[model samples]
Target: MSKLSTYVHVPMENRITVTLLCCASFVCIESLRKNWRPALTHLSNGLRIIESLPMSMLNKLRDTVSIYGSANNTEEELGMDYILRLFATWEVSCALFAENFKPVISVKLYRGRELDDKPLDEFESITQAHRAIVQYTRDIFALVWLFRDHQGDDQFWSQPIPRRQHEILSHRGDCMGGLFERFMAKPQAPPSGTGEHYSLQWLPPTVYPNLIASLGIEGRFKLWAEDPSAAPGRRFSASNRATTSKAAYEMRSAKYPYRSFSMKHNEETRHTYLALLASDGRLMVFENEQPENMSEYTPIDELSICTKPSRGEEVSFKVRFDPNPDPCYNAMQAGVANDSLALVVAGMAAVKIYRSRDVITTSYGVAQTQREFYLALEVGVHRGLVRDVAWAPGNIRGHDIIATACQDGFVRVFRIDTPHSSNEGKSWSTSELPRYENHQVQTCSRAGQLNDKQQHQSGLSASLAKSGSHAERHFSGQLGQVKHACKEIAKLDSHRTPVWRVGFDDDGQILASTGDDGKLVCYRQTPSGDWAKSSELAIVKTRMATP
Candidate 1:
């Protein structure tokens, strides 16, 4: 306390003396000043500081509030708080209004037809019938084109002009005017000899209320009403009588059914279905319902069975398999031959071979023993686990080479050597070796398979040793070192997951691969002499539900 009092007293005395001196000095300075320049300069500096104070304080306040405030809060309680609250409420109300409102409109189709005659209740049915008619007309047009191109016949074309003109006139009358005059036309008697009669006729496009239009004699026909309660028995009889009158008309009603649809040709034991490209370059519709007769081959130019409309049909290419039967999954590999013969690898223990020239027939070439010409290897061990097989593009030493990729992350190439001498009884022999030319092995990592501590410790060492041993044994031996003239030309790591299927283009320039990832990767050999993935195409992913 004593030291603090002494220091405070000295400072107070010094402050008083300094204050008196500063006052005298200020008075002297004022007396000596001829003008007010120094005082004005000091005033200007003070004004500048005052001007900057508000901005500095505002920035500090902003930083302090930001540090303490909730980020989600939109409004601050300084000036204009009420206005901000009002704006926020308005924004919320606008959002609510937008959420609750929905826009809708009734879409109608308007052509040169009367509103009163349009079928309002049977709108859906009328639309479907109209679509079917359009398709049928297009098909007829295509057939006409094909007939002209292939047959070079002008008679079929020249004969139908008058009929087409009559049809066009009828369409104009029905469409432009509300005319039910043709509806009142007299009914003609059924044709002679047959209890029921049918005739092919065309109807003018018109909007008939609750009615389906059918062809009639001299601008006359019956209206099949859309009412379910309106005589179902009559409807069936009328439809049948219309279809059965002529052989061409009856055949037009024959239905073609398929169990499934695929872009490529698919087959089972008794039936085969192919997707035929129509002459007009459109994909014809495939019927999934089973056809009535399996024995009859339906050409791609048949008519509809239910509607009796002429439409393109589908055909099957048949191949026969001989002797005993063996069921195999994903075994057939298509080859380079223009004929659609698929090389089938089958059998449970020892893989047997068969070739199907066509898919429909069960008769095929007899099974060939695989062990006769090649090294005696267990089918299940070496080739039995073969998941995908491919045929090389070019002939290797006058023999075709086949490559098989297995489930155990290995690929092997085999050459099909047909015996040169006619004295040799066997049809074919094989020479196989591991495909190692310019190929790299992607070994499974130890971390991937190790489950226990002991396994983890020994995994790396064991894998390394096994890899080394295999390399020395296979690559160092004389047979292994000898590279066949027909070694694997290219090897690629096509997928991260397992590759399920492989396909080659007609020219063998592009390779397409599919895998568990549900992606189709196309590879092309580049100018740099490396197989590089060119593009990836999207595929529909199929998921199998667990039982």
Candidate 2:
């Protein structure tokens, strides 16, 4: 393979520029071919090729972009300050990646680190245990840099995983390198009372403060999702819509947009979706390009997602599932089935869904038009509004199982399946989907009531022994090609306050949720279809230091 790598040289404190360069440039490596020189690839039309970079170093410049330009813009306080603070630790991440790809340090990078007072340590591990912790520390620290919500929310990067309520870091955040030392039980204790500026986490295992300093082309797109400017503020309301504009609140801008929130794709279908929870109780769906055939789903691409419609019109979906839509609803979570026929929406109201023959797609097994989606099933989970919803992939138990986070501070589970009719996930079980004769929805829980106007048309059916007439049985199946859309599985008083999000991981066996208490609880599915809360992780907020 011809060499396509480039090298970047920066002599001063402009680490951000280095990061920008990292994204825009490629690390130029010498061609391994003995006789042939490889071609250099440029990004867009106006990128001046800085040819004739001294290629004396062999694998020395591997896995990096050689940036050879000067900056034209100045950094601002309100604008770049947030990013500066967040990415303050990113230079370390760059170094790690650089060491992975190329061991030799560049002269410019070496000098800049000495000036910054972040001297380097030998990039070697003492023990496998410390090494594992070091790896996790690197990953989570990077996640904090890219995904944390605000600068002042310092706890995200270093907060302790508190086991007791009293230990919650509600008062002050933890130090960066403190956790690693504690976990590793290093020979010497971390400093006792000094508060000097330190990149504890970024410094350990030999500092590469500017290692792989760029987000790269792919990472540049990833940055769009976590841009600090568009992050949601604390005080949100319906009339006072989220500060994000339609253009700014885009998929490219907000994919995995929230701090520590998980985004899922349909496991079984070619159709892909990214759901964003707007501050004022709204759900936005960004889908990948429509597929060419039933057996094919176009691979989701950053550019291919539909953000604008043909007429340049935008749609704002109502969160009717909010127990009360009168005020601004806190839309929490949304999910789609692998088969692509069912959708589950959860927030500060009843749990709502869009379940139809192809509610999300057209008759041709293509992407569904926005107009085709309507509330097919909406059920009240808690007396207060619901917070999150997660749908498991298809199940052999024959139902669309779902989990919910609620404002009432409960994490509940529900199953939406029809036993009488084949209202199961065989939505497209194979190349040729098998169709089951639509039967009456045998039962709607005694307390659960449908909220959609379409619900009056749809009815729930009872068991064969409890049925009165064919009409009553027919009415229960009114959800248009769906039956038994929701039945309460178990409503655990999971948290004392509101539960923020609930979801089943990819496997569909384990469920997880995060709450206002700043704790993450994972529940596993027993062989008998029962859910038991398993483990918990604390991600608490910084509590003010006591005066």
Best by lDDT: 2
Per-residue lDDT of model 2, residues 366-445, tens digit only: 22222123444667646665655666753644455777777678888887654342333334333223212111111122
| Model 1 worst lDDT run, 10 consecutive residues | 102-111
lDDT of 1 by residue, 128-170 (tens): 3333333223323323322435354556436665345335534
Worst lDDT run of 10 residues, candidate 2, spans: 324-333
Residue 328's C-alpha lDDT in candidate 1?
15
lDDT of each: 0.30, 0.36
Each candidate's clash count: 15, 42
Cand. 1 TM to true fold: 0.22
Model 1 spans > 4 angstroms off: 1-342, 346-352, 355-384, 390-398, 401-405, 409-415, 419-492, 523-547
CA RMSD of all predictions = 35.3, 26.1
